[model samples]
Structures are given as C-alpha cells and as structure tokens.
Target: MDMWSYFYTCLVSVWLHRLYVYSAVAFGISLWIVIQFTTTRTKRKGKKSHRNPSSPEGTSDKVGNGCAPRQAQEVHVAGVKIFYGSQTGTAKRFAKALAEAVTSLNLPVEVINMGDYDPEDGLAEETSSRNICVFLVATYTEGQPPESAAWFCKWLEEAANDFRVGKSFLQGLRYAVFGLGNSAYVDHYNTAEELFETSSEEEAGGTDSVVDVEDLGNIMGNMKKAKREQELQEGAAGAERREMITPALREALTKQGYKLIGSHSGVKLCRWTKSMLRGRGGCYKHTFYGIESHRCMEATPSLACANKCVFCWRHHTNPVGTEWRWKMDQPELILQEALEKHQNMIRQFKGVSGVKAARLEEALAVKHCALSLVGEPIMYPHINSFVRLLHQHGISTFLVTNAQFPEEIRRLEPVTQLYVSVDASTKESLRRIDRPLFKDFWQRFLDSLKALAEKQQRTVYRLTLVKAWNVDELKAYADLISLGKPDFIEVKGVTYCGESSASSLTMANVPWHGEVVSFVRELARLLPDYGIACEHEHSNCLLLAHSKFQVDGEWRTWIDYGRFQELVREHQRSGGSRTFTAADYTARTPPWALFGARERGFDPLDVRFQRKNKARDISGC
Candidate 1:
C-alpha cells in the first residue's frame, strides 16, 4: 500500500494533469483557427475595406493614358488586328487584343502567331499579294527574327517579292506594322524590327546610282557622327541626308559593297524610349530594311564584353554568366559567311523561279562593310587589323564604342567617322547612367573624350538624353563637352517601348523639339565655344561643335572622299598598324563643320502615318 498504492495514485494524478494541458492546447488551437477563418472571410466579403495591389515597378499598364476610366479589360477594341511573328507569348497577348478589336468592328480577319504556322511551306505570292499584310514581328538575339518569323520573313524578303510564282507577287500588298521591342534588348528590338525593307543592297553592278536607304545600318549614328562629312561630300549634289551603320553592319555591307550615304543610311542603336528616335520612323524603319536584305552572318561568334553599362539594350537572355561564346571568326571569314547567308536571304526571297540570274550575278559582286552591329566592336582583340582588311578592299567602316576601353579607341584606324557614346555629364552621373562594370570607368570615359578631341580623324560624341533621368544636368553636360571638344555632338532621346516600357517613362516625359532646343540653348550659353550647328526634328536630336574649329563659320558640311581614300591607302601600306594618339590626330585635322545647320522641326510619328498609308507603294517593287 505504501509503495504500490502511492505509485498508482501518483500515476493517476499525473495522467489527469496531462489531460488538462492537452484540453487547454486543443481549445486554443481551435479558437485561433476560427478567428483566422472569420477574419479571412470578412475580408473576402468586403466587410473590411480592400485595396487592389499596386503593380510591380516597371510593370504598369503600357497602353494609353488614364484620361478616361480604366476599361473593363486592357484590350484596345478599335485597334488593327495584329498578326505577330513571335516566339514568346508576349506578342501573342498583343495580337489577341489587336484581333479582338478588329473582330469587334465586324471586320473579317485572321490574327495569326507565326509560331503556329510553318515557314517551310512557301506562301504563294497570289495569296499574300491580294491582302494587306500586317507584320507584328519580334526579333531574336543577334538581329535574327524570331524562329517563327525567321524563315517566314526570310522567305518574304528573299523570295515572296518575286513576280513569277504568283504573277503579281507582293506588288499590291499593303501592310502596317507595330514592332514589339524592349530598347534594353540588343538585336532588332527583340526581333520585331526586321520587316521594313527587303532589298537594300541589291546591286545590279551597273551605273545605277540609286542610293539605297535600306543598306545603311548606322543611319541614326550617321546623323550624329558623320553628318558633316556626308554634307561636305554631297555639297548639294542631289539631296544630303545623314548615314549610319553598326560595326557588324559595316562588315556586312562591306561584304556586300554598299556604302552608307547619309544620316538615313546607317544603324540606330539605343535602349528603347520615347523621344526623337522612336517618334521618327527611320530608326526602326531602316533597321527593318537591313534585316530583310541580309541573313544574320555570325553563327558561332564571341559573346563576351569587358564592361557592363546600365543603359545597355541587351536583354536578360544575353550571356552574362559566361565571358565568351567561343568559335571566333576572322573578319574576312565572317564577311564571307555573312555573304553566303545573304545569298540564302535572297534565295528565300526569290519565289518559284529560285534565284534570278541577275540577282545571283549581283550577289557574286561584293562592295562595302561596317563593324558596329551588336557588341562593342572595339572589344574584339583584332578590331584594328580587321578594320584595316576592310579598308584594303575600299570598304568604308564606322567603328562605335562606349569609351570603356580608351586603348582600343586610340589604336582605331580612320573610318568614315568614329563615334563615342557619352551618356552622362559628370562622373557621378556617368556611373548612374552607364553603370560601368569596372571601377575606373569614369576615368576611362574622360580619357576617351580627351582622346576623341585629339584624334585627327573625325570624332563624334553622342549624348543620349533620357527625360526625368538626365534632363537636369545641363551645366554638367556643358562641362563634359568642353573637355571632349568633339567635332560633332549628337543629343538624342531614349526610345520608349518594349522592355523599357516597364520603367517609368511617358510620352509626356519625352522632350519635344522645343524642350530639346531649350536644353541645348541653355548648354550653348555655357559652351560658347560650341554652337548649336544643326537641328533635325525628324530625328529628335541636335548637333553642336566648337566655333573656332568650324571651316567657314557657316554650315560646314562635307566629306573629303579623296582624303578618306588616301587615309585608307596609308593604313594599308603600314600593314594597318599605327599608334593613333588622339592628341597628334586632332592637332592637324581641321574642324570640318561649324555646327550651324538650322533647326528644322519635324515629327517622325506623323511620317509613320504616311509610311503606313502607302506601305505597298513605298516598299513594293
């Protein structure tokens, strides 16, 4: 009784205590669950006021503004039916809404995604010729159209224009286009910008002095870099426009023997935004043209870079984890492969007749080249020697750089004109805007500016203006300009669309001509040495240069073709090797232009309406 009875009693008391604790825990848990359920239900029923979650930064509604109430859906019910040439689903969403709007209007239409169709099946010219074509294309990396649209666009450009397969061909086919792109993307505005021109460099090898607008890849850059040189060359010959081309395009065009003539002839490279570049249709217009004419040349090219800038147009898909893509090719080999690819591009365009004998013969004869396409061409170890090789063939080259590597810039040969993109005014602003990968990028940029000032070759400083971001640094900009003393200064606005639309940009934020004039005018006061030489409203940019450096203090616009040719010969004689100290070069090179070209206020968006309205007449053969 003392031991066993006590042990049993103690056990019973302990069991009772345990039961009591368990009951209390269970009760508390039940109450908590009940409370949570009641609160959630109350919120769901709107017993408590609820707020819609705000969209993540850079993911706001990209359609029209909020002057009216938010519509039932994000779709624009009155827009054109979009047939997107896209690989990803983004273009699909855009096309769906576009199709819905067209459907609402009771218009019989087909809203097609290129991926859903087979590009291998040759589209009959009669089928395509009868209808108005609407191309909503998205470009892939390396300026290649999306896989879905790739073969389709290739076929369309290289073959669909032929009159034999379907008689009339694309002769009467009218079309409108809306390219979906992110300026952050590098190639073809994410591939949508490959639809404007089909045969920019179709040389018949005769005395046909037709200047092809589609052949120029650096047309935008030309307006900034080589406008004066071209103006000097043209000298009111017929009409003078700016020419631009990318380095890659330069290489390709060299392989093809097409020269960038004026501001409208070259490549327009930038991050997407709304301002002068996009408002004017030419940026993408000419780009669309280039993609059509040439198949992307480099297949297994290097994809490495030394610096990573903030305002880069490259997409997230770019290889950031790795330093290179290996399988590098010589410039001449790259040019050869590119030419072969170009033939394929033409073959795809040539319909049932296959390759026209004339076209095939023309393809055999090659001409000029450019080097500024996607990556920083200067970063290539063999850039100098490669440029020399093109020069040897009378191929004009335009080398563009971010000024990240001044040493490369110093070693660069005399091309048509060299471009250095200076994105900010001050060191701090430079860091904020360019977001350099290296610690000493700011210093490197300064050295580049000074080097550009010193170079005997034509040096241009390109300043891209992003509203609300770099609009306030007028004084700082003037200071930087003073240091560089560039022959030409091109101030352009960011293109707002695609990936950049995710950021805080508005049409209102896009500085108008008046705004740009005001800013440049202010900077002009500080930069008394540099005058506002010319203004092009269609491009949404301005040009400035040192007054003392001007040739006649008037609009000094001319390119000494003879001089350029002489320099090429000299470069070749020296094994394309020369230590180009910017200091020594600029010392003897006279200022070519007064930067006094008048301000012509024009709107490119308005021109787009005209282009779209007369699409067939403008693009058709």
Candidate 2:
C-alpha cells in the first residue's frame, strides 16, 4: 500500500507540473497578442499625431500632407491701396472688384476697409512712393461719411489742427477719390472733395495731386462694370441711364430715397402722395382742378429747362437746353415710360403698414399728370403731342412753364390747367430771380404772359414769394397779374431747403404763412378784378380768382372736369379750332374750398361740408 501511495504522489506531481507548464504556455501566447495589439494602437496614434502637426502634443513636423507649410501671406507694402467706405456694401464690393482688376494687370494691389485701416499709421509713407491710393466711398445720411469711415473723415477734417499731420502732409501722396451720392440732397457729394481738399490743402496751396487724372475714367468704368454685374445677378432688366448718374448725384438722390426714371426723369414720393396712399389727404391741386391728388402722377416730360431760377428747387443739376438740341424722345415713348415709372413709384408702398391697399390700387391708374416736376415741361419738343397723348388716355394734363418761351406757350394746346411761373414783379427782379437764358427775357416774359391771357383753358400765374426779394413790389406784381389776367394766382412762400451757392438766400428769406397771407391781401387790394378764392395752409399757399368767376357772389373756382373733357373732345373733333374758354366749363366751388370761408379748403372728412350740402353752402357762404 505504501509503495502504491508514493507512486500516485509522483504521478500527481508530474501531472500538476505538466498542467502548470501548459497554463504558462497559454499565458505567453495571450501576452504576445496583447503586446501586438498595444503596439499597433500606439503606431496608429503616432501616425495620427504625425499627420496633424497642429495637435496639442507639439509635434515637430513642419510639413503638412508631404508639402511645405504655407508661408504667411505677404502684403505688398508699396502697392496701390484700394480703401472703401461703404454703408450698404456697394462701395466695398466695388473696391474689391477694382483691386482684383488692378491685380490682373500684374500690379500689386491691397484692398482695405477704411473702417479697419488706421489712416494716421504709415498711410503717408505707403502713398509717398509711386504707389497710388484709391478711395471708393459712399455718402451716408445728411452728407456724412459711413460710420466706419467717420473717424478717417473726421481726422482729415481736423488734420490742420493735428501737429503731427500737417495740411500738406499728403503732398507727395497720389490719391483719387470716387464718391457715391444722390443729386437731390444739398451737399450730397461735397464731402469727398472737402476731405481731399482739407487733407492736401489743394485749394489753398494750388498744388494738385501728381496722380494721372486719366485713371479716373478707367476707375469709373470698373465701378460701372461691377455695378452692372451686381445688378444682373439681382435680375435687373437693362442698364438704365440712371445708373450712369454721377456718383455724387446718384448718392444724393438715393440718400433722399427717390425712385429715378431713366437718367433725367425722377419720381419722388410727396407728402400728399403718401397721405393719399394712406387714405389720409390729397394734393393742393385736388382742390383746384378737381384732380384726384392721390391718383396724380407727379412727373416731368422734359428734365431740361432753359432757365435757372434762383428759387428753383432742382439746384440746376437738370440739363439746360436753349432748344431741342438733345435727342428728342417720341411723345408716345415718353408717355409710356412716364406712366410705367409712375406705376413703379406707386408699387413700392405695397405691404406698408399704413397704406390702404384699395387706395394704392386706385393710385396705380394715374388720373392726373403734374408736369410741374422740377423742369419746364414745355421745353419738350413734342409738348403738344405729349398733351394729346395724355388726354387720349383720359389723364388730365396740368402743364407748367418758366414763361421764357413765348413761342412754346403760344403753340401749346389747351390743358386742364396751364401754369406760368411769374418769378418776379419787375424786369430787374425777373432777370435776377428767373435768370432767363434769353437776353430779351423781359420781353419774352411779357409775351408769355400775353399769350397766357389768350388761353381758353384754365390759366394760372404761380408766384413763389421770397421774403425781402420780390415780396416788396406789390404794384409791379399787380401790373404783371393784369397783363396775364390769369384765372387764378397762387401766392406761396419760398420753401427754404438749404444753403444754395447759386442764390443769396437765407432762412430769413423764407416768409411765414401769415406773411404770405398779408402779402396776398395787399396784392388783392391792388387788383380789384381778382378775389381770394382758396387757401392751403399746409402748403403755405393762397389762390386768387378773377371776379368774373364769382357768379352771384358764389365762387366758381372748382373745375367741371367732365365738361372740360367733353369740350376737349369736341375741339378735337372740330380739328382743335373751336377753342373752349374757362367759362365754358365752369363749376361751382364749395364754400369750404373758398379762402377764409371755413376750415381751409375742401376737408373731405368734414361731415358738415359734405358734397350734399356743398351747393347750398356755395350760394351764401
């Protein structure tokens, strides 16, 4: 038994040893596998770290994807600097496109935003070389630079005061500026010139920049190309001449937010137009000519005029023509364009909070055309044809002339209302105020007035009174009024817009409504044949009608529109020889429409003065 036990122990020991050896071999195999997996993961991580040199581990590989790392962008220190001061991003985009264009010419170019660039730091040094500096800036609100460029402009303005930067510090600098602005705002494009002049002292020193002025045309062409591309991308139809407007003028008009038509014609939204769009009010003409002021298309047939009146609101930017020297547009084309532009102007108010959709729709179908928009409409070569075209469309025509062209007025067809601007009372004042082109302007003025007196349709003498200028000559004004013998006289105070270099006018020159009332009263006292018929307080205007229109103590100032159209048609049928007079289609004027009778003129909302009681009130009131 003892021998068997010892043998069993030996056997168990041998098996245990073999089992331990087998377990050890299996553990070695597992260890080898674990070691291989760990090595593979470390190799993968090492490869990832090598690929991404920017990793936080700070790897020393200066190459990326088997290529040398990109060097820092080199800036051309002496290259042309294209700086832009943009409000709506147009100027900036233009600057970028210009820089690209210049670079394509193999010239070094650097585009910059004026807002980000420090003008005081190395600007003089950079521009001191043969390098040029180009500024494409836009005029912001009220003739100021964009907010980003305000600091630069202010610095330029105060450069004279800065001891470090002298007035002629930019003397060696070659620079050109392109300003974007509208023509409507006074001093619209005046800021850029002021900035350049102030910084360089060019006006005082009489030393101009050595930069070639020839480059200006190229720069303008590039800007135009950029604008066209942008417009095309935005689905704009054709390249309108309005796009060709000078940067300054375009900026000014754009600043004032005018919807331009073509190059010359403009469609400005008036307060009356806005009021009418909101179903609030109408224009002053609505009371006089029975026109729907809301449905009135305030536009001009010809943007060119012969005269440059000191009191003219257009600021003389419009083309001045002695005759039909310009490319004369056909009457049909003019009418079509004008109507389309008018509709476009009206359409912009769509979806506005206060605008009545129904009234807006009504406004789209223009019922009246005020040709008094900024120019002498009669200067259009086809004036008669234009008038006929307007009438054929059932649109009443109210034409205004500067009284410089007697022949034009004589040949003009009868309109719903014809107005001649009686600028001044005396010949000297007329010469100074009207600033007529004809040397014999006084004779032309007299002849024009005489021709106006013979007109069968409604004739008006519109007198714009500038205090301390022509308001003193009451007898002279009365004499001129007698010459024209107009059916109505509009006495209005001069609206003082701003400082005009063309005229010696100040805010003091503009009269108050009370002052206008006093002047009109004095004038009415001088002319016994005329009576104060109507007043528009908001416009600071008063109307005087001839006594003959006052039938049985009732004023007949309001026009019979239907009867006038009938007479016009009849005259057209009779070959336009059988002319109609103002009395032929006289309509009774409402009492409220008469001056000093009730609450100003024709309050459409006045329940007491409804159309039902208008006739009964006219006889007594």
Candidate 3:
C-alpha cells in the first residue's frame, strides 16, 4: 500500500472486506443448520410407525411370544429394541413405560422378553437393521441376572469373547443397558449393570436418550412407590391391606372358577378330577391311596396360611398370619356351599372336550375331600366340625398343614391322612424355604411333629425337595424323620409354577422324575423302618411308608374309605374318647400303584396323556 501509507490503506480495506465475507459465511452456515434441524424435526413429528399414538399402552406393540400374533409395521426411527429381563415384574414395567414413551415419538418399538428372544438368531438382525437395543435387566442375590435374562446375559458375555460369533458379537452394535434394582439392594444390581456396560463399552455412544412415561413420572418417584409396595409386601403395612379375602381377591378367585364359600372357604375343581373324568388317570392320591380322583372335592375351610413357601401353588396370594384373625364361617355353611359349588363346576364340564359323561356323573357325587387346596384348614376355628361335616357327607378327608401350629395339630380330629409339611430339615433351611411368620416356627414345627406322632390316625411328613435347596440334606432329613417318626413320608420334587412374584423358583429347582427316584432311593437307605412304598412318575412324587403300612411284604398304603368313615363316626359318637387306629382302615396297595412298576403309579385302567412343558396342579397337596 502506498509504500507505507498507501500499503496500510490497501491492507486495511482488504482486511475489512475479508472480515465481512467470513462473518456472512458463518451466519449463513448457522442459519442453514437451524432450518435443516427444524425441517427434519417437523417431518419426523408428522411420521408415525403405523401405530395410533393415542392407543393405550401395550395395545399396538409387537411382543415376541411365539403364539401371540405380531404386528407388522415399517416406519420411523431405526427401531427401539427393548429387551427386558424381569424377576419381580419391575424391570418389565420399566420396559413397558419406556416403550410407551418411545411410541409417542412415532418410533417402531418392540418389547421383547430376553427369555423368549434368542440372541443367537436375532441379535445379528438387530445390528444389521440399525436398531438401538435397550436392556432393562434385573439382578438378584449376588449380582445374578433374573432367571428370564440369565441365558441372554450369558450369551452376550460369551459372544463378546467368542471367536465364532463375530457378526453377532457386540463389536459395533449399539446398546444401552439400564439395570433395575430395588432400593433395598443397590450394589447387588449395579454390579450387573457395570458388567453389562463393560461388555459393550466400545459400541455405546456418550449421548443417551431417556423418556418418561406418564404414570412413572421419574426414577425417584417410582422408586418411592416401589419402596412402599415392598413394605406392604413385607407385611409392614398389613393393616392397610384388606381382610384375608378381599372383594378383589374374591372376584379374581371366582373368575378363575373357584367356588368362594361364605367369605372365607373356597373350593376349586382339581385338574386331576378333570383328568380322571376324561379317563386320563387319577392323581397321586388315587395312586398312593384309595381315594377316587373323580369323586374328590378339593377345598379349604380357611383361606389363609402361616408360611410363604417358595413353591406355594396359590403364588402366596392367599392371606398369611401367625394366628387365626379373620371372620370364621360355620362349618356346616362352608361344607354346604363348597359341595354345591364343586358340583356346579363339575356340571359345566358336562360336554367339554375330553369329558366323559359317566365320569362326570360320578364326579357330581363327592366321596373324598382334599382339605389342602390353598390354605391351612387347621387355621379355621371349627375345623374339627368341618372335618365332621365332610365325614357326615361320606367324604373322606385328607388335610395338609404347614406344621406351624402345634396345639392345633393336637386338637385336630382324626383325618383319613394328616400331612405335616416338613419342607426343610434344618432351622435355617426351614426359615429360608417356608418364610413362616412365627418367631418360634422351628419349635412349633417340632412340637407339631410331636403332636402328629400322638395321633391315632395316619400321619405323614411331606418333604418337598427343591433342587440345590433341600436335596443335599440327607442326614438332616433323616434326623427330622427320627424326631417325628411319621407313619408315611411323601417326598416330592418342588413344582415350578412359572414366573411368580411370590417365589424366585425356576425350572432348575424342579428335579427330574429320575432325579427324584435317585433321591428317594438314597434317602430310603438312611431309615431302616421306612420303606419307599410307591412312586408317582408323572407327579415326580415318591412315598415312604412306615413298616406298619407294609404287611407281610405287601404295602397297605391305600385307605379303606368306608372303614375310615365308620371309625370317624364311632369316634364322634363316643365324644372323641374311642378313636380308631390307622391299621383298622388300611387297604391293600395294588400292583400297578406300587413303587418301580411299569405304570409308575398311573391307574392302568385309565388313558395316559403326555403333557409337555406344563406345570403340576399342586406342589405339596
């Protein structure tokens, strides 16, 4: 410029011009960015993944059950794959809420159970489809994943390190893991989350997307509610809950085809009754004893129990208490309604599939009563009279008790066979398995056994063997048997009821029929006097009869029902002073019903049907 001045002036002008152009370019670029963002958002808002956003939650989503029809849709975000593993339904709920929130954004979302979803086949598809996989995983004791997600988590961990599973392995696949845990045990669950994060550390982006469902406002609020629920479940707010039998529970029971009698007692038609009515065979009782399954009424005088056993068939929904507190219905009224309702229910199966007309007619005339349906019948104030009422109707009674009440056991009138649940041998094991409400539960259990030993009628110790729980305590179980000296020992594999909040029991806990036989065979060697009387293969149950039930090398496990009823009447007439002994009503055990037979305790006269992957009707009954 100018030499000094001219050059300075030129330089200033040139510099100013360059500055103006640079500023303009920067502004234009910023404006373009803003417009592009707005347009993209507007377009996205207009688009829907073929689902009505206004529809109720869980109405339109594709859940991956093999039988449920899946909805076909194509639109919106890459996809939201919500893979949930739930133990107590909390993680499942979180996944549902998140799915609902994502749906509002017009995103194609799927809520899949990790148990149902095979990572081996479908995980690669997620990566190729450009979907963001979200894991809502729940972990329990010792940082263990929920049973539903165990395979999933294990697959992921192994695949991440496995050389053969390259494409499916989470190398570039995007994922977000949200660990679920109750407030009670934070660290236990966080360990699971950390482990998952470490497994997928490479693929996860720094930014995360989180949306809240309307009902579950925030994590803290949801956690607070969960705490309250947990407290209620722990019986801290027992009074806040309704009576033993609430209207809601009553309605639910009625819907499930239960015969609710007099606000307390209930009767449900046993599946065995249905089975025998169809000539499919009688239940274990029909095999082990002389009770006709088609003619048995499964009922309970009390709708309450004292123990929260891990394998409770009712899912622990029935009320629990240490003592009787609910309104007690008269024995006569309960029996009347139970029989009427049972007969009415039996009538409905008149023309149903696989029902036999002749057997249906036989089922209408109740001859045996199983007072072990849902609760402790002994808890009823007038259970003795209830038993008497059943006997008066010519219904032989087989009652089951959890052995929490010793005095009640002593006062209980003679039943055809009285069962005391010896779920575990040791005190610690019993506490873990039964979860009894009484502080002196162990003592009460021992005393109940003592009381049972004094009864003239047949007495049994029911051993429900849960694999990895009580199966290894051979010596301890033998010790308990010595203490009670029960007339019979019924050892059964714990039945898996399938995904109950009341228990964390999985299919693993259920021992195979062969395994049950192995256990029974081993246990039989420990006791010299008790012999393995019979085995019900279908039920995975084994019976050990005292030497008394074995007469001249033949088993007399079956009950003489007519003789038992006669003895019950005699005892009643004599004011309970002249009770009869179990031997007086003993009946000969048939060859087919004996242990290690080809029929495996199934009545050879009846048809046999194989049910695959179905749960047993009762665990300990």
lDDT for each candidate structure: 0.50, 0.73, 0.79
Candidates 1 and 2 compared: the better one by TM-score is 2
* Candidate 1 worst ten-residue window by lDDT: 288-297
How does model 3 fare in lDDT? Answer: 0.79
Task: List candidate 2 stretches off by more than 4 Å.
Answer: 1-266, 602-621
Best by TM-score: 3
Summarize candidate 3's per-residue lDDT along 1-621 as a digit string, tens digits. 448998898889988799887999999999999999999988765654434533332232322222343233322236688998887788899999999977876778899999998987887666555566788887654567878888988877776666665533544455667777643343343556666665554222222222111112144456688867875675664554335689878877777777888767899999889889988888898989978999999999888887768888777667766666566678888888888999998999988998989888888999999889988889988998888888898989899999988999998888888999999999989987887767678899999988988888898998999999899999998988888888999999998878877487899999998988898889999999989888888788989999988889899999888888888889889998886899999999998899978778888788787578865432221
Please give the range of 10 consecutive residues that has the lowest summed lDDT in model 2: 58-67
303-364, model 1: which lDDT tens digit per residue? 33443444454322222211222324456664445455444534443343322344334433
State model 1's lDDT: 0.50
Evaluated at residue 603, the lDDT of candidate 1 is 23
- Candidate 2, 1-621: lDDT as tens digits: 999999999999988799887989999999999999999999977765454222233323222222342332122224577888876677888998989877754567888888898887857675457566888887764457877788878776676567755556666566667777543334344466446545555422346544432344345557678976876765555433233245566667656655555555555656687776775556567665556777887777666676767777766666565665344456777678778877887898999987888888998988888888876788777889888888888888888998989888999988999999997989888866776666577898999999998888889999999987898999999888889889999988998777654455788988998999999999999999998988876578899999989999998887777787888988888998888898987888776667886556645542222256345332212
Looking at candidate 3, the ten consecutive residues that score lowest on lDDT are 208-217
